[model samples]
Target: MATIFTRIINREIPGHIIAEDDRFIAILDINPLVMGHTLVIPKEEVDYIFDLDEKTLGDLMLFAQKVGLAVEQAVPCLRIGISVIGLEVPHTHVHLIPMNSMGDINFSRPKMNPSGDELSAMAEKIRSFL
Candidate 1:
């Protein structure tokens, strides 16, 4: 079965996409930790990040770096924090979170419930930086 990230990559479900290349896609997290929180995922849908081939892993980071730069430009933050806690979903994903303080990227903290419109607007803002 296709993972939810694959569905989003294929447009099977709605996603607030910020950017995409032939290999990876960047989209806003629906239950975001912060305003510009984004997920960078490989279209191939490997179950674990470490399981990915060396080239793919390198490409993924490069892709995330591109998105992270845009997120920093579009969102107010001291820096973009990267995380790889692939427990909630089956597919490999990198979380690019905007952070001004240490708690900003805490997964233990409750996520923000932004409306779809809010997500879409945030997506557009991030895309504008790319």
Candidate 2:
């Protein structure tokens, strides 16, 4: 079975995509920790981040670096916080969250339920900077 991220990358499921290259895609998290929270994932459905080849792993972070810079420009926050607790989804992903404080990246906290419209707007905002 294809993972949800693959479904999104293939357009089998909807995703508010911020940026993507041939190897990876960055999209807004539907249930976000913060307004500009995004997930960066490889096109291949690898179950673990470390399991990726060194080149893919390095490329993933480089891709993420570009997205993180754009997210910082597009969103209002002290800085972008990165986390890789890959438990929520089977696909390996890096979370880029807008953070004004330490608690902003806390995964245990309740997630925000932003409307689809809100997510779409935010995605476009991030893309503008890309």
Candidate 3:
């Protein structure tokens, strides 16, 4: 079965995409930790981040860096925090979270439930910077 991220990448399900290239895709986290929390994922569905080959891992960070810059600009934040907790979903992904304080990246904290319109607007704002 395709993972949810794969489904989104394949356009089998809807996603608020922020950016994409031939190898990777950036999309808004539906259950966001902050206003501009986004996920950077490779087109290939690898189950673990460490399991990716050297070149793919390096490319993934470069891709995430580009997306992070846009997320930082689109959303007000002191900096963008990166996290790689892959337990929630099987596919490898990088979380680019806009952070004003330490608590902003706390996964233990409850996630924000923004409306669809809010996510769409945020996605547009991020795409504008990319």
- Off-target runs (Cα >4 Å) in candidate 2 are none
The superposed Cα distance between candidate 2 and the true structure at residue 95, in angstroms, equals 0.1
Instruction: Write one digit per residue (lDDT tens) for candidate 3, span 9-67.
Output: 99999999999999999999999999999999999999999999999999999999999
Model 3 spans > 4 angstroms off: none
lDDT of 2 by residue, 1-130 (tens): 9989999999999999999999999999999989999999999999999999999999999999999999999999999999998887899999999999999999999999999999999999999999
Q: Give model 2's TM-score versus the native structure.
A: 0.98
Q: What is the lDDT of residue 110 in candidate 3?
A: 98
Give the per-residue lDDT of model 1 (tens digit) for 44-114: 98999999999999999999999999999999999999999999999999999999999999999999999
TM-score, cand. 3: 0.98
Query: What root-mean-square deviation over C-alphas does model 2 reach?
Result: 0.5
Worst lDDT run of 10 residues, candidate 3, spans 68-77
Candidate 1 ranges beyond 4 A from true positions: none
